[model samples]
Target: MRALTVKGVRIDDTFAEAFGMRATAVIITADSPRWAHQAALTMTGFATSVIGCGCEAGIDSELTAAQTPDRRPGVRVLLFAVSTAELQKQLQARVAQCVLTSPGSACYAGLDGEERLRLGNALRYFGDGWQISKRFGGKHYWRIPVMDGEFVCEATTGLTKEAVGGGNLLIMGRTAQTTLAAAEAAAAAIAKVPNVIMPFPGGIVRSGSKVGSKYKGVPASTNHAFCPTLRGAADTALDPDAACVLEIVIDGLTSQAVAAAMGAGIAALVKLGPRRGAVRISAGNYGGKLGPHQYHLRDLTP
Candidate 1:
């Protein structure tokens, strides 16, 4: 495996190495893309890792005005969990707590034929248990009358084995501004692709985490290798020339999804990165043993 080097940092050729987990996709629509993304951003906030967030989620794709039921712009988001039971619990909390709370936002099951169900029924109780049920296209929907208006969402959703989290990457850049621009560029490339998500703010995170922790109370701690503050320490591992690092995280539920995401993310960043060799990209993993899937940055670009 090879990595693109910039500012003395390495863009590791190794993949994210994710595993199969149960997944669900949600469709959120609103009066405008602004509102739609508002719902999406809020719903997906703090959902960086499944270990702490219960589920990992991101904006899967954007829907054109013609494709939505409300004839408005929207975003499709996918969430995955390690266990079926955990996924069920997440469905209710994310929908009720995030999607439902966003004003003028309505959620639908992007995965329409889910044999198993969770949210629609449980959240209907939020309508004071007076919610009205509607059926369209042989699919059950719940109309939860709210103070603002009606909240229409799908009842049952499809559940299936998905790659879950098999794709991801980390991009490091010299300046915060440049890093953001490059990360956004990468997100723009991946945004239109199906079955993938950029996920975090600007589709990037400055602080990534490690599997174990030095503190007994904290199950995880910030990734020190990528940390700029600890760069000068003799015991540190970061390359001497590394200035700053920005991380871009990708989510894909399929091998194709993983490939496409890695491809777009790398290609876009390469085109937009700082010209003074100030940017570099890499992947994080405990080793090949840590994750079932592997993504090579070189292969993605090639």
Candidate 2:
């Protein structure tokens, strides 16, 4: 395979091994885009990874009024979990707590998959006998009265079993600030890619973790090799000139989408020029033991 390189920055030829996840797309709509985003951000909060948060989710994209079921501004958010049961639990809790409470917000099934999970069917109880069910083109929605008005939510949400998660790229730079800038630019570029989401703070992870931890109770710990201060002490991955590193993690509806997102992020970072301080692009994996999907950096490069 050809080695990956752009603007003199070395791109590791290894793959970012990812695994299949149970994912569902949620459509949250409100009176305006601002309110739609408010619900989206809240629902996806603290969901950077399944290892810590029990789920992973992010805003997939925004939808125009014409594209939404209620003809309102909306956002598409994806939630991924290790199993369908866990995913269903998360969907119920998040939508009820976040979207159902957001001003003028409504929720609907974003995907048309056959496997469904209850949403409004369970939340309607909050109305205490006043909730009404409406059928729109065969889909059921419940209107539960709230303080402001009624909160409308669909009866169920769809699921995809083979969704891929944990695709990532590492940016090594001469300074922490430079590494972060490159990561931010890469995230902006990745955001434009369809069907994928970078589920970390500002789409970047400063504390990337490895699969195992030194402590028995913890399943993961900070990736010591990537730590600039641990260069000599911890069998580091950095070069002599490297001073800091940041990682961009991506989760997508399909393997193809993940690869496309990775390519877009790398291309965006390359535009910053090699002299901008980012000297290398790498990936994280567990020697092919972690997941079945392998996104190769070499294959993503031109």
Candidate 3:
């Protein structure tokens, strides 16, 4: 599949073939951004991918104070990987290491369904089998009594099959300020749609990673093709006049949902690109290395 470019847009002829993934989202609430950061950072730390971290997780989005359970600042984090069994193990470990250790931190399932599930319940047992389960507004929740109060979390994750992991688009501009502005605008637009979420801060990643690095003990490295500073890496795509580029990584239950976010996101970006030095917008792919899903920018053109 190929993405389109018009005017200030620069589409790439590539496809993001994502494989089926078993994923989970946990909602963490804290008294303030400080506390929220405390919980969120701890929860998502060391969880860059399932290959090493046993789960690929990131903050899906930031929830405004009013949107949180206790009217506090919080964030929704998405964790995904290859299987439901692995999902359980990874989540169990993550919860034990991150959320369990953070004071005033509470976790809730962002994904739940009629399908059979595990994580939340199995891990709750760590409460020395004294955990209390609560069902509020048709959603089941667990209140694990902690010294700091109670660690509130959703009882189960919404598990699905054939999930898509990477739906990314790059925004190029003349300056970092402009690039950031455009990326932010696009992120806001995509956030309005359901069944999808941007997994990075403000929906932008300044440093893009490639498959491997030459450095010792580095399995993955930065994507030099997209970096303006790495121009001599052979067939790099950097626009010499380009001052900055930002990436947006998206995830969804299905390919269509991801595509929808991409389309809407690109539309919102088109409106800000020119003024903010955003000369082009493009997508990233592994040269058809991913499995079956493809989103074309031409189809998403506004």
Candidate 4:
């Protein structure tokens, strides 16, 4: 494949290492679009990485009234875990805590019927025997009586094969302000891509971490190599003009989706112009000792 570069920003030849993760797609709906988004943001909060959070999740997209099960505006979110059992626990907890509790909000299976997890079935007991089960369009739904009338939720959601997670991009620039801006632009562009989500806050990670840490109990720690403040004290990879670096980490439904997001992010940064201070685009890896999927940056754009 031809190498990819834009506005003097060189795309690294190395690949982003990712691992297999079980994913569950869920739809959250509320009485108003505002509440729908509120529930989505709440459900996906603190789920940027599986290392510490135990799962990774983000809003896939918003759905129109005609596109939702209840003919209401909604949002689709994808939750990924290391295993099906763990995913089931996370889904049940998120729906119960975030969606079910949101005023006038309800949860439903976003994936088409296939391999399944009994999410609602486990949560039905919250009704304390008052919960009612209904069959709609050949699917089971539970109506849990709550303070605000009822909270409707699907009994099961499909669980697909463990897909790639932890695809990332390192954004380096001449200053903290410019680097943050470039990272934000790249993140905004990636959010528009289908079947993917930037799990981190604003889709940018200022404290990007490595797999292990020097402290015995810590699994991962800040990547000092890319820290501009630690340039003289640590082994740095930053260019001479680079004053700051921010990383965008992506977790997608498929490897292709991840690559597309990375490519789109690079394109967005390219549009910001070379003077925007985005100097180099690189990726995170463990010398190929990590996951199976290796997303090469050059091939993503070329």
Each prediction's TM-score against the native?
0.86, 0.97, 0.78, 0.95
**Model 2: per-residue Cα lDDT over 1-302, one tens digit each:** 23467778888788898899989998999999999999999999999999778789999999999999989999999999999989988889999899999999999998888888888988999999999999979899999999999999999888898799999999988888788888888999999998899989989999998767879988888899999898889887788878989999999988889999999988888888566747788888888986999888888875
Query: In candidate 1, what are the lDDT values of residues 1-80, reduced to their tens digit?
Result: 55565344356656576677778888899988988988987888877778778988888877878887668788888887
Cα lDDT over the full model 2: 0.89
Tens digits of per-residue lDDT for model 4, 174-283: 88888888898999899999878888897888898876788898888899898888888999877688888899999888888888999899888878855774778889
The runs of at least 3 residues in candidate 4 whose Cα sits more than 4 Å from the true structure, single-residue gaps closed, are: 1-4
Arranged by lDDT with the best first, the candidates are 2, 4, 1, 3
How far off is residue 239 in model 2, in Å? 0.6
In candidate 4 the C-alpha lDDT for residue 174 amounts to 81
Give the winner by TM-score: 2
Among all windows of 10 consecutive residues in model 4, the one with the lowest summed lDDT is 1-10
Model 1 deviation from the true structure expressed as Cα RMSD, one decimal place: 2.9
What is the lDDT for 102 in model 1? 87
For candidate 4, list the clashing residue pairs, or say none: none
Which residue runs does candidate 3 get wrong by more than 4 Å? 1-7, 29-41, 49-52, 59-76, 101-106, 132-143, 152-154, 212-219
Residue 166 CA displacement from its true place in model 3, Å: 1.0
Q: How far off is residue 168 in model 4, in Å?
A: 0.5
Model 1 residue 71 CA deviation (Å) reads 3.2
Steric overlap count per candidate:
4, 0, 11, 0
